[model samples]
Target: MVFRFAKTLDPITLFHAPSLQTSTNALNILKAASAAATAGTVTSNRGEFQLEITTAPPTTDQLRNIIDYVTANPAGAGSNKTDYAVGEVIKGAKDAEDAVKRFKEGGEGTFIRPITVDWTNGKAVLGDNESEILKMVHQLEAN
Candidate 1:
């Protein structure tokens, strides 16, 4: 009489290191975008501005940090101004700078610059400023 034995096998496991890297890159991009939006508020005489992160949609704590920084460091008015109009311009400049820094720091892969100011009316009105921001983001991403 002859006897036969059965064999057992285990399946292969896969890891998502690349996906994690991509996610990290995306988060970095968002952070950069927030910074860029804030940086866009810088002016010559007037100081930088801040934004209300709670009102803005899809903004993270990192972005809110920029706004908070500006609010804490108001120019002439010490956070008691009613209009907050000038602050808006400063905020925009700061936001742009932040985005640019992120792009240069290797956040071009998973982010896009926004195409609109976060205020109703302002003096630093540059046409297609949003497009300009997007262009910077795309440039970084392409690299």
Candidate 2:
């Protein structure tokens, strides 16, 4: 008899800055959503997920991956490509290279706060948009 094990998913991560009010609001939302998901109250096809909140900036590699994820075109016919830019992720960044430069010079303060990332689904939200964040959390799995 063969037993199939369920895949372990990456936690939904929130890159937050406590000093920012928007980040605080996002944190509250994430907490509530996390509880709901754990309690099976979230009507989502993706099921329950773990929440990870961090105050520190993402590493260079992580930042790159997030930019890629956010800008990637959704798979399917006639799907419009996402128009997101690196500046959306890193405040005042001119481009990906500039983002890295600014991050290196300014450290954590350079990163935009209240960003929510669903690593398992390769989706991210740059601000405390409650509806958008929730949508990502409850996104249906592609067939």
Candidate 3:
């Protein structure tokens, strides 16, 4: 057997892939950590933590939110094709990036059409709030 080096786990700053209410353990850990935290316990008197979300690595939920936003808020009179592309993403359940690309490539142009994506190749990860996703999608709609 060979020796392997491992670092100590940091409970206070846990970083788990965000999901749609899927990470119960992470929630538990946060709750426990917050409860245990006290003055000077974790550099802050209050149990405050910072969360960041990025679009480079979006999640399935984000994809859904984008579709929902596009559906609810139609961009323009000729945005039917764009809307349909969003539908294809949901029906196909494509990965977040793939879905975004589908909408971009298939939407707008009269000859454009949504394409199929191999769902097996998808490896989506969660970001922050769904509203953040809506903003990104809104930009797509404008284009």
Candidate 4:
């Protein structure tokens, strides 16, 4: 008999802007969650994960991915304008195209901070709601 354990590659990324209080809070929360997961105090179907924290705005490709990920998962929009989910991630973007345009014009300054992305599970949470953030963190990975 052969025994094998598949490696877990799930990465939870936090797009943080140090100046913003909300982003700071989200960072702290994610840190705790990461610690809990490492300590086995937190359990998820996804099990262990690597938390990537970046103060820099995501790259253009990353921005598009974040927008798409959040759009597909509307819970990420929170109570914001659901009609234009892009605006939830990018401050003034009306849609995908507008998001790119505004991002080009304003650069990193236009991004709405404190977005946490669980890329492997296609889930993203925008803003500092501890509950929402934690929910996204510990949710099971869809098969």
Candidate 5:
């Protein structure tokens, strides 16, 4: 949704959100908010908008910060960014075994994974030594 600044009842600001676990850097939105809030009262700020995506996973810290922003900065009377977070991380675990244990116990969403790993790149690439090796590796790691 494209937001018109002048039409809005109050002024506004925006911030970039977490890019799943793939990235942990601030995007253009965050950069802009940083400039706006560089030296001022946060509550007095006109508004705050969170840039989020449905497909990409959201980090815990990102969700927390977004919730705080939504609570502190009212967005013209609306439930803001409630659907922005759709990510569940396997935290406090380093090893894969521990991570799986934590995820199985406390992970947010149910990851409906395929029964087997498909080695073919569509119909273009068939099975090969690489595929066989991958199959072996996939089998070595039990479900």
Candidate 6:
């Protein structure tokens, strides 16, 4: 099975495996980075985030796992209105073209570029690095 892993802008180590454990591990990393970013520890110098994967195009289930994790985490929204909205947008775009671009570029080959998120200007942008999964939930709640 082709496994895809997505990570933030920080230099975090990851475990590669087709198990929930791996997914959970990655989620934890995201949570920490998100928290650090919120606390001003991880600034724009990180330049968004990147999601690294072994698949040419990550599967929906893989993406959903990461999205679900973020949605259930505090770093995502934390009850902030603007942040929540941005999270919603990120969620909605999970299956978007941009999301597809964020997936690792390889598989039948090797070597891939990292994805970046645009957190500046309060604009929550999802990419290979980070995604705004909570944004979708917040949008649904607003409607």
| lDDT top scorer | 4
Candidate 6's residue-wise lDDT over 1-143, tens digit each? 99978653533323233334434544555556556555666443443344333323235443433343333345655543232222232323444344434433323122111211222212222332223332321122322
TM-score, every prediction: 0.19, 0.82, 0.21, 0.82, 0.21, 0.23
The reply for model 1, stretches above 4 Å from the true place, is 1-19, 41-143
Segments of candidate 4 deviating more than 4 angstroms:
1-6, 72-84, 140-143
TM-score for candidate 5, please give it: 0.21
Ranking by TM-score: 2, 4, 6, 3, 5, 1
Residue pairs with backbone overlap in model 3: none
**Segments in model 5 whose C-alpha atoms lie over 4 Å from true places:** 1-25, 39-77, 84-143
Residue 17 of model 5 has an lDDT of: 26
Whole-model Cα lDDT per candidate? 0.31, 0.78, 0.33, 0.80, 0.29, 0.34
Model 3, 1-143: lDDT tens digits are 99988643222222233443433443444444444443225432223322222213224454445444334234566532223344343434344456666545554321111121112212121232232222222222323
Tens-digit lDDT track for model 4 on 1-143?
Answer: 99999887689999988888999999999899888887888777656688999988899888887887777445654432112278888887888989988998999889888889888866788888888777778773332
Q: State the lDDT at 113 in candidate 3.
A: 17
Find the 10 residues in a row with the least total lDDT in model 1.
Answer: 8-17
Please write out the lDDT profile of model 2 over residues 23-106, one tens digit for every residue. Answer: 998888888877887788878877778889998889889888787766646574643223477787777888788888898888
User: 104, model 2: CA deviation in Å?
Assistant: 1.7
Q: In candidate 5, which residue pairs get closer than 3 Å at backbone N, Cα or C atoms, i.e. clash?
A: 16-30
Best by TM-score: 2
Error of 3 at 33 (Å): 2.2
Each candidate's root-mean-square deviation in Å? 21.7, 3.4, 16.3, 4.7, 20.3, 15.0
Instruction: Give candidate 3 regions above 4 Å deviation.
Output: 1-22, 43-47, 50-96, 99-143
